[model samples]
Target chain A: MSTFRRRRKTPCGLLSGLLGVIAMATVAAQEGPGLGETPSPEMLAAWDIDIGPDGSGLPAGSGTAAVGETLYMTNCFACHGPEGEGLLNDRLAGGHGSLASEAPRKTVGSYWPYATTVFDYVRRAMPYLMPQSLTNDEVYALTAYLLYINGIVARDEVMDAETLPDVEMPNRDSFVIAYPRR
Target chain B: MSTPEFPEEEHEQVAGNGLLHRRLFLSQGAALLSAGSLGLMTARPAAAQALDPWLLTPGLALSGYGERSPFEADVARTVLPVAGTTGSGASRTPLESLEGIITPNGLFFERHHAGIPEIDPERHQLLIHGLVERPLVFSMEALSRYPMESRIQFLECSGNSRPNLASTPPQESCGFLHGTVSCSEWTGIPLSILLDEAGVSSEASWLLAEGADAAAMTRSVPLAKAMDDALIALYQNGERIRPSNGYPMRLFLPGYEGNACIKWLRRIKLTSGPQMTREETSKYTDLQRDGRSLQFTFDMDVKSVITSPSFGLALNGPGLYQISGIAWTGAGRIRRVEVSADGGQTWAEAALSDPVLPKALTRFRMAWRYDGGAATIVSRATDEAGNVQPLRSDFMAANGPQVSYHNNSTQAWAIDSDGAVSNVYV
Candidate 1:
């Protein structure tokens, strides 16, 4: 947390220094027409919704799996099955060790590499019928329920910004990046 | 040596199964009629010709936005919405019915995660933040101020030619099976200039690009690519981009998979590592035969398909026909495209058309003299990087049958004795 704070602060100091250096160096030659405006924090907050694997940009909200289950039944059960076995939409749970099988069922527990993506995707594009309608707390509960159903978390465990980032997913170590190889 | 008095045989086979030489058209255009080998210019009984009604009458006046001929009503994109969703699917370009390399703006293939968002360019703003000394936001008017460059490039969905992976060939048209790829002239500002203006931090290695659509389609692109040749494309095919193809602006990464070019591009945040977004991790990744999926497989490998004389495009008692097709490579220009009349047993080089630009579709043609026998014709393209389109068996062996993305194998079209064409595994 201290490192994150320091990293964030260093950019501002560096930016001020960059302004002076850029004025002398004429960095505008490389940069295109300087017409872009510096976005305010509130403007940034409205559109900056992406959550990285390390829990960056995760909103402040908490929900337990028990609460998540109720939210799931009400919001997600129509498309995603009751236990996330999948019906009209994507299956969100189970398929823990099926990646190597003849017919791999790539559900959340099976192929996804990060737990934060569960929260990120559910918050942004879930329910299929009406997306981006869930509250941050409701999104947290739904994500918690999915994790619990996938057997990655306990039923009573609380999922928030702090604890969600620490949930080590099953397929976290299975990915192999194919670009910019050394 | 003295010139021979006798004319050379116009129908001489260059390769197995009646594959004529590339110069057959030039050498025997006038002679083909006298020899009666090609039925293209046979003499017919002269009769009094009647003028058509349109020739005698005045044509309709032009409209604000001109449209194609009403006679060409059937030549439209094949829309395939997902079973449960309205707009969360793809529409294929009509490859077999079209000619030349440039896909018309309207007929361009579309793959949307959510429905096309109705974005007012006046209201939309692009934000560039994270791992940068200066976080900047550019509106449409501001973005247009920057100098731009245009290049003719091809964008292909990794899932194009997916039907070729099946054990038995699918009896579908070339467009239906492999129409998710299209080429266009994209004009846009270079992303490197924007990144430079934003003062990218040296620690950043990846960029998370997000769209403004309901799905908020997101993908992580390597920073090196952004600094190399990525574009903030606003105009496509000499006009403002269509709404289905990301109207206001889109991230156009030349030669990369189509999905990575986020439509309705709204945000680009620099990061130290990949965000492992849903599209990259779970959807677009290539699952191999060993059950290990290959992530960040951006390059859409070398591929080719014979659009004409393919399935559903039957020949009329084939005497002479020009086998035309489009060949492309994600790495660079297509160096060579070879057509096979005998289904890969023998190969003959096809004549590439003019303006063979890098990362753009190259049109290839081969003259053929059919003997009215059953035959399988296929095209094989080799890119500047020397990457040849893999054989079907070889490609299938590398990636299992279940894998859907990045199928760039050679496609074969079987011509029966009745001059009927059908998709076949040769």
Candidate 2:
């Protein structure tokens, strides 16, 4: 790789090589001749729980808005309010036509460009109090309910990994690559 | 009311001839004493006079560590509350009270998503996996054994001057308006060293840097950036990094937005493409006029802020004053900083402090004579790349009023007849 070749020309490479030799010698004198331990696949998987936009890491689960209503009321209502209008926390519904307005209310329906982001955020961090406590099915149901309330999907439409990424959000075409341009 | 404390004979001697003799003798002695004391005072070196009283007296001897003078009050980061819990807010550096280009380790700005996590260095491990030849787990001790590099750089929140975009900007101190950014000398191991040790695969194009905080805040950095100037920072201002500033370690992206720096760095997972994390998509992305949000808007544009004679500072019937501020650019070194006393009609170059490293804050100063009339003072920065700071109006016209991040427009501060300063749009 070019990155590897470039590393040799950098000052960091020269210093690291010198240090690596000394570190290896020190380790050999003590226990063994290695810098770090090899990480187990299980250990990596425990923390490697990131879902990509292309639906790479989504867990298998399916639910409809009808099933999500009860979960939303119990788990999400206190913060997001009934109908997802939002009260204590961020407003998830409405703001569809407010993007061009002077006072833009950037909600789930108004600004978020990707549908997978909603699922990723809700799964990684949600409820404001208890995070990562929702089951895969519960996350799917909540995602469907949020999409339904935002007028992106029908109330009875079932959402799973295959169907969730296909749902075209209103602002899907709103994002443009900013870096490497200016 | 009670007066008979002295002996009758002593009182009489004091009041009578004895008093006259005592006065005469004391007058002669006073002259001699004054001469001797004056000689002693003049004999001492000029440098000795500048020493503090504690330094003059033999205080505590050398110890394991040193501390600032007790007389100096602890300058803390100014915390601004936002929605959510206390940890979900931001704190700014007291830029007005600081000197030199490097911000003190403690006063550096802080922005947390969920909260700061208490991590044990012994238990903490930084995993370098995903598209690597060898998936390695490094302990804090092991990480320290690697070669280290130190650099002076500026880290700024993308929303540093977000309030300036407001229709009515807050009448606050320069530190409050522009303090969300800070410059520091950071010491750390170049990430390329570790990445090379793991032997990064050719297919990896992006690296997801995740923090160990409660939020587990994550941002996808381009592989080129990670290998370029990025550092796994361990020290700030030559001391171990503060707990609030990521303690054990943090990823330092030279000129990128502060959020991408990822405090309390725990993992670096190489991938083929950006993960499009919640932070990059929902929050840090910038909105434009055509309703098209700009994604991966990393570079902070050229910006300058007048620290002195800024908002909240009252100039007392001004004569001649030294106007000072800091100017920086994410692209390169600041080439020039121009100050405007009568809005933008007239401009004067400010003297820039030396050792103006690229991507570091450059301190600039200028001398001004105030006529005591109403005037608007501002500073505009021009970077080495020839990117000049834009006007607020021009910036708004292009980015739209709804845009909230990456605003590097020139700031104007109006001076009233009473010598009071306020943030204003001229």
Candidate 3:
């Protein structure tokens, strides 16, 4: 009976002086307002889409270059060119041995340090007009197709989270950290 | 080329090609006015002019917001969009037309990959997760309640001054050649407070900051920098941040390149190592002469550029003119700026403005008396860290000729006998 009465009076008190009570409690507790809420797992699932080079956050999916060709023609060719030669947007393939040349062509196959970056970028932003719209499998296929065209992977090679992290990029060891030595 | 007709006086010639002392104007303003028209004040006689309508009539009523004068409409940032797109491009600040160090919010340069997003402050939230003891989310209102601090700092894109890398000097305006940098007074809550609230894990060495735009831009920053002086900036130039500059909030790392200061910031995840995002690997990396590339280059090099008497701002009849420019360094405060008027054969120390804060633009000025001859002029800056700005040839020799980023070479402008100024490789 006493617990029910205390719970019944709580809503009325909250409606009357909730902000003032919280303000006082916050000043007594910490430096900040301390209004940060613990994010739920559902919220994390919806927004935490970044994938590390070690394939830490890659979702469950599988695809091949053959399946990616159709998706590429439908969505990517308008901006990135038919063969990834770069039409209106950036070039995605070729330029394997041009880094030291007078006119270097910086592309994914030639300069990218990690293969996981391909999946992270295409999943978050691709097709120029519509970003964050591709599914996990479709993003994997596109990554496979790009790697295949660049001669990094075979046409029939499967690209899942397990195999994608092992695909070594040619320029993986070509970088040196330039600042904040630690 | 003709010499000065007036008699010689206390104005000391500091360097070759008629470079005068730094304090010529301040020490001898009244005496110099009696000498001649110093070539700057060319206004028409006021006695011959009638009363303007603005003075004779009532002015417009008060407004909630204000704008620059309509007569100054021509002073605008020059935008160059990417092919077949309107937003994925850069716009340069009119550095030549502006005065002082603080760039007005409207005139700040912009380099956006997926355009600006109109974010509602109430709906925006900042999530701190990953290798943190407490994964938390804070609303804009909650963050606003935290203690805030304000700082005046300069932000520069690493891609600024790309034309200087060319062997032949390109004919372009000073702003067009090197205007990707701007300074502003940013107000924000120190990011350390938020990190403290989140209780960062001991294993975390780096953190990935992501944006809320269509591209969802992301970059991995060292935890040392975050624990240092980084901020979650909410205001620019004493007002709410402009849409193009990250409306609700943005991450601001003092002295770092502009792109690393993610705009429209939404998420931060502590990690054991860098995520190696495409923005860092496929782009923003600097290529070296020996085929190796420099990654995670955050600090902008010490640099300076002369804004006045540059290309398109021709010298009128070559009399006494004030040479002015801006200098900044990511390492620390700018200690000195030297001006050269005779193709860098000699240099004269210019006067730096007061309160030379670190990571902020320092305005330097020098008094110069032109001799109506073809002359090459330039400026170079030295920071408190003992690093001097390099010449184009030396910079290119160090970092390959094909390199396109962090080109902090001195810019040379030539003034012909006809008083027309153009970019020249000296």
Candidate 4:
């Protein structure tokens, strides 16, 4: 118990209140809805995923910033922005000089470390439900479109195999190397 | 309280909101059995029993074929409840309630940030481009012909834990905390063969895996791990891989973090290094003591905990309850599991479900009897490499505040006099 988080000072009350307080604390700490309770362990393997910075999870599908413009305008525009600018969906890109600035801005071009990740997320779990329902081509295009909307890619630039990975994200070096070995 | 052992005793209650108990939703017609034939007077009993008529849908004996779970009586779920913000994703599977190794494929639990996709396995081709001398596209059939191997393994989501999942009375089932991990005998082609076919370029240091699932789930795995023990799985548990288990194909990185195993996999692009994504950056990274985040810490460090005799269970005077649960690790295999009814104060080795394959969920059981007083039950697992699971206290002391992900800390359950079980962090 010593190593556990130091117990907060108990609220002042009667002596008998202590047992009730502990019981209540224990009750509150049940910590789970305790549903099926079967560790299944089998299902665990089914739900894991990794979305890369470059959006590696992006499917074979492709999409364009224009189509992304239409999709964004319809579904995401309300949350992201009119043209991927900072708004409800947060900044899609930019913040070029905000890395070390006081107000650290997390934009696609400035803070995002990889382009594959944008594709991965957009495909794997995006639009939330109906996840991965988008055609692979659509994900690639949406990735391209998002990049383009962030001013990272040119409007007419076809975002496909040849151009996708080469699209250097601003945070390429923004992230320090993880998994360092001694 | 002496209810005999027949699954038909299955509880059938639908909460006002439509979140079936995960399993209850499976046999929708199971409860439609007429009690009049069984000589029961109550209509409620008739509404909850499985009749011989329903099991004949595809027949109880599934010869040379896989069948959807006959036990999904309570699990007619579309998606997990989204309880406002502060939540990333959480989904529950039917575990404690499930029997046997192979969980019905469709009833398999899913946790997608985006959504599931519909792929025409024919039009869907896995493109192995980038940093490869020969960029090849293998149709699902072509890949199936490659040297195939099968594995009984478990995949565990890094963030699947219930350390702070509640502020109410404890949940009465074990599935909530441990259901995020499951095991399956997945058969697939060796990625090494595919990479060899693609003729990976020498400069290729990282291999990026992508899935068709929305969120276009992607992750950058080291080329070494990629070529070492990776798989391009095509089938799971003797059937064509279920659409959710990546269907046409998925990249299975054995014994590594679950996210690295891309589902609905469609492509593999060899690259230079870790491509930090939202999963690698904004989430999944462990914030350590010195304000540093732990990354690339891949192998689910060998850990195990008893799942049964866990929270939300009723003691029923505890004469002899089988203390059983799962133990596993991304590091090789589980060597041994020890259970303690007294919270590790004393210990005894538990029997492991045999063929304890590497990177798989090894089930373990030990008979435990309660002295009829307040008591704590805990289980610890040791892997083949001799890595032992740490105690909750030890974990708390070393790790400090736990993160939302990768918590394999030892779990304990305390039984009260009233026969209620709750999570015990001790």
Instruction: Flag regions of model 3 displaced more than 4 Å.
Output: A1-31, B1-9, B25-47
lDDT values of the candidates? 0.85, 0.79, 0.86, 0.62
How high is the lDDT of residue A91 in model 1? 79
Off by over 4 Å in 1: A1-30, B1-10, B25-48
Error of 2 at B34 (Å): 33
Kindly list the per-residue Cα lDDT of model 4 for residues B123-181, writing each as its tens digit: 77777776887666666655544557788887877766654323332454556766666
lDDT of 2 by residue, B21-133 (tens): 12211234323223222211113444565658877788877878776676556556678765657777799988866767999877899998877778889998999999999
Could you tell which candidate, 2 or 3, scores higher by TM-score? 3
lDDT of 1 by residue, B287-335 (tens): 6666677889899889999997888877767566778899998888999
Tens-digit per-residue lDDT, B1-426, candidate 3:
122353466468999998877665455542453343335334455576777899998998889999778978988897988998899889999888886899989889999989899898889999999999999999997887786779999999999999777778889988899999999999998888788778899999999999998889999999999988898999999999998998899999999989999999999999999999988888898888778898899999999999987888877786777787999999989999999999899999987866689999999878787878998899999999999999876777777766988889898889999888899875
Task: Report the Cα lDDT for residue A26, model 2.
Answer: 75
Arrange candidates by TM-score, descending: 3, 1, 2, 4
Q: How high is the lDDT of residue B353 in model 1?
A: 77
Q: Name the regions of candidate 2 deviating beyond 4 angstroms.
A: A1-34, B1-75
The TM-scores that each candidate's chain B achieves against the reference are 0.93, 0.84, 0.95, 0.80
Candidate 1 CAPRI classification by DockQ = acceptable
Count residue pairs with overlapping backbones in model 4.
89
What is every candidate's C-alpha DockQ against the true complex, given to 2 decimals? 0.38, 0.37, 0.40, 0.10
Clashes of 1: 0
lDDT tens digits by residue: candidate 4, A15-129: 4357545754664221111111122334323333444444443334456777766666665665566766766345776676654543445566665666776765665566643
Q: Which candidate is the best by TM-score?
A: 3
